[model samples]
Target: MAETITIEPITRIEGHGKITIILDDDGQVSDARFHVTQFRGFEKLCEGRPYYEMPAITERICGICPVSHALASGKACDAILGVHPPEAASLLRRLLNCGEFIQSHALSFFYLSSPDLFLGMDADPAKRNITGIIEAYPEMARDGIRLRKIGQQIIEMISGKRIHASWVVPGGVNAPLDAGHRQTMLQMIPEALEIIIRTLALFKKTLDQHREEIRTFANFPTYFMGMVDEEGNLEHVSGRLRIIDAKGHIVADAIDPADYREYIAEAVEPWSYLKFPYYKPLGFPAGIYRVGPAARLNVCNGCGTALADQEWAEFREIERGPLMSSFFNHYARLIEILFCIETMQGLLAEPAILAARVRAVAQPNFPEGVGCVEAPRGTLIHHYRVDEDGLMTWANLIVATGHNTMAMSRGVLQVAKRFITGAKITEGALNRVEALIRAFDPCLSCSTHALGQAPFTIRFMKTDGTILGET
Candidate 1:
């Protein structure tokens, strides 16, 4: 008889999810699905709240990317109030984003995925974790911890708190970058730059050994989307949207993020709470595309910083067109950290960053607003509709992980088919499947924000694979 294999509470990811693989009577894999098992309706929850409170309220979506949420929410609130933050505020916001990228990416690549890369994928489950990494590669593990700390330190220095900071507000941040904090942040950059350089070298050295993994881990063609500056350099804050085809051709360029509905649409699946977003013109699954580190590199013309630009060129050389495999996200993340460090150093060196006029006082001047930013994971968008009194009537958030849902689901099937040939499966094969999802570094808690009642069901089953009851 055919059977179903389920990997519940998929490990090494930010939130809860599971993978179900279906087998044919001959024990051949037939289908697979990735199910995001938890849901927190931040959009719905924000209804009726004051629009100005959005920066703090919506940021509760995920602890890992709270800075991203706060920034996006702040931008939308900026629009609602019809005011622009001072130049110093803009610079500080971007600087904060750099810190967020470093910390979040370090956590993804080191604490979560590094074990599989260092310790074998088939290593005992208990040992295939951060503790094992610490035991085996003490120096490298310390580097990861230190790098993440520097990032959080930058945040604390700028906003008074690292996570869920209320400093980011409607018109601008609550305070300006002081001279003391500026010097401290600048001092930290050198160490950050050093760590990233060595880590990049170490990772490159090991690439040859993971050839089989590189070949199978979500290595498929799909459109890519990300934010880019006017010169088409990789941008994390305040830029227009760019979508490139798998062949590295620009299908859409300089799209006003406010017009996202014109180019993007969301669809629902019965088995998962996460909504699948795709390029609108192509429609549904056919419009499937990817976002985040790999996609960001694929869409940008260059990194705009010296060291990262050189690495970016070398990375692109992997394919004449855009790199398709999500596995490269790991490599792309390291490059981004290099870019962030360099970018932060430049921003802190600017004298105007210490200006005290950081905020613009304003009342609600618009009833609708939208904001966009490149979160550590990918592009994050926040849209809001408000009453004349400034109370939120409705809101929607398109998180980075949500944008990649289709590709991830399809990737699970591809990996499952490649490794599961019979009823019996190896532990390594199962891990490779989970590792495929890890490549995207999904924050499931931030993605599953359905507006209304989402499709859900409960089923009780026997140990022998028989369904006993349903709800």
Candidate 2:
């Protein structure tokens, strides 16, 4: 008789997380937990640093979404400096943001989540990884890898290195965009566009095959949130916030990012270190909403890129304008990739992109500042209070992954009940649990929570019918 089930260090994901299902005396799933086993003390380490260094320092939060951190921190630094970045700098910042969205989203769908989608969820546990994906579809594998490389290449070409910290700083970019680099990047745009379009097309075909699965897979409704442009176009940076209900009614619109704290509040969950962020109007558990690709796609009007705009419309048609399924989050990631390539192409045509004046000189002037930008994973916010001489006094970061904590727990419980039963635990049952977590494409490594293996076994006290311990 099987007593416990554990999924340790789930594969093809960035960080460490585990889920255990304990069976009871009657062989029922007695308890379920999705625990994040890591810690990152960025708040403590950030103290005492000058505000000007925040952009680079905070960018280290997540290698996957560093651009989001850089942008948020840079914006906070801009607020601290009390100067608006030049139009050219704003354009470059948006361009870099597109690169981040493309790479991070690609990593989420193509690398982490696709394994279960492409190979059946019940596919051999050992072969159900990227390696399994490579053997099954070599070109698709190459596409995801090469496509991610293009995004990193853009970041490197612009910032002087991959994951280059400090390229963004108070008031403006530390390194200006060079004419030659833009030209080089411009040359690659056509190829990049083709790659994105083709990959998206292929993904659509896969989605078509899995339409039933996509619809019913994880169809639970969620309150959607994201920063949208003033005109309601999907905003990755510098826009008013919008929150919409599952049925597509605009619950809140044109909300400024600065007033974010007022509209959103964090809630603690006993099972996970990650905090759940929800809309204030609805209150705690009931207000539990979702952020990231699923939330962004649901609330945004369009991607603002020509080709991606067309694909975005088609995506909307599939869901009759807004998709809420956590599964389609994969589709949303691809759509954004299409948008990023298109956005990058549009930026290249602008003379300012190739212009010399990317940075404006300025000095920090504020005692407190807040920075926010949509990371590929979700909306990332960084707030800091600085002393007159610019010594950091406090740090508060609301990571994209943290925003999904509520939804993730819900997803875990939902999946556990669906696949886990009185029968003995199997690798497939365990994969379903991990697969549910991957659906969020969570970035726990980048979030406040750290990443480490804590292999655990959950056993039941069958005779007394008491839940025992984490062994």
Candidate 3:
């Protein structure tokens, strides 16, 4: 008999999901799938709204990466208006994004993932949480909290609210960075940098303990994708898209964000709501690519910032080719936090960042536009088409999490084959399976938003499609 093991509602992720590990008739792990069970209809809901309302509306996608959506949407609207924001507006936007990167990466590293990395994977489920980590490592926990708070403070200082702040507009930001607030944020930088540096040093010392995971955990060859400057420096707010293969050779470079639809396409799977995106030239599954911290680091020549550039060099030294191990996403994420702080400090020191002319006046001049950005998770693209009256006719959003959906599914299978036994699945093995998903740091809520028929139940069927069971 072919049996299947199902783990429902994978915990510690942004939204609800389930994993099904399929077994062969011989009781050996055959394959696995990651399913996003929820349906979010953001694209369909925004159809009749004005294009100008997109920034505020799309920001509701995920509480964690709302700023990513807001900025991308704003950029798309900027295209529609045929106007460019003032330099100060662009600087402020980058500063806000840096804050987002710091807070979000810190949350993933400390609150969600530290328990598994610091404590044993087999630790009691109830005890493997932020509270547990706090109890075990009080000072470290406090540092993480303080670091996250500093990022949130930066966001609030510029945008006026921590979440869903409509500060970014079509052509630019609604306000400039206040002098007093800028000084306050500048003061917070050194402490934040110290926290990340200390945490990174401590994490580096533990690499020896996770040698097995480092070697086997989703450590496969896949093309990497992210934005990069013209000089191939790491960029978060704006840049051209770059895709590189497993051997560190650039497959595509200087690709325009406006032409994304020509290069990228989404593949729908019957088992999950999330769509799989692939490079169009390579066709469907073969075009699979990984994004986020690891991918960004792999695709970029340098981080452009001084301290981060030094860390980037060290990160690349771990592998002659691109770093393929998902386990290193943790390290990549911390280094990004360091980069975020350094970049934020540099932006604040610029006098032009305080200029009062933040926004440009414009009316909708284009019928269609596309906007792209490096969300904390990965590459995020927003596309929109408007009617003559400037009302949106259609919208498409490719979130960072969706870009990595194909890779995450494969990661589950790889981990299952390594850790799970069909005869008996232990808690430790199950934890490792879930850990693989966490390694990708996917945002299910952001990935699953589309209009479609949603299947609420998952069927456990044989390879030949005979139904074994459903949940």
True lDDT of residue 138, candidate 2: 91
- Tens-place lDDT digits, model 1, residues 1-471: 878888987999998888878788999977776677776778788999999899998778889999999999999999999999999999999999999999999999999999988897789998999999999999899999999999999999999998998888999899998799898888888899999999999999889878878888878888999999999999999999999988899999999998999999987666644366889998755787899999999999999999999999999998899998898999999999999999999999888899999999999999999999999889999999999999999998999987887677667767888888785699889998999999999987687655323432222233222445432
Pairs with steric clashes in candidate 3: none
Q: Candidate 2: worst 10 consecutive residues by lDDT?
A: 455-464
lDDT against the true structure, per candidate, is: 0.88, 0.75, 0.86
Candidate 1, pairs of clashing residues:
none
Each candidate structure's TM-score, on Cα atoms with residue i matched to residue i, is: 0.95, 0.91, 0.94
The 10 consecutive residues of candidate 3 with the worst lDDT sum are 451-460
Question: What is the Å distance of residue 409 in model 3 from its true position?
Answer: 0.4
List where candidate 1 sits over 4 angstroms from the true fold.
268-274, 451-471
Q: What TM-score does candidate 3 get on C-alpha atoms? A: 0.94
Show where candidate 3 strays beyond 4 Å.
Answer: 269-274, 451-471
Cα lDDT tens digits for candidate 3, 1-471: 888888887987777778888798877887676667777799989999999899999988888888899999999999999998999999999999999999999888898888889876889998898999999988889988998889888999999999999888899998988999999999999899899999998898888888877776778888899999889999998799999988999989999999997778887666654366888887765777889999999999999888889889999999998998899999999999999999999999999999999999888999999999999899999999999999999999999887887677667777888887777889988888888888888887787776223432333333333555543
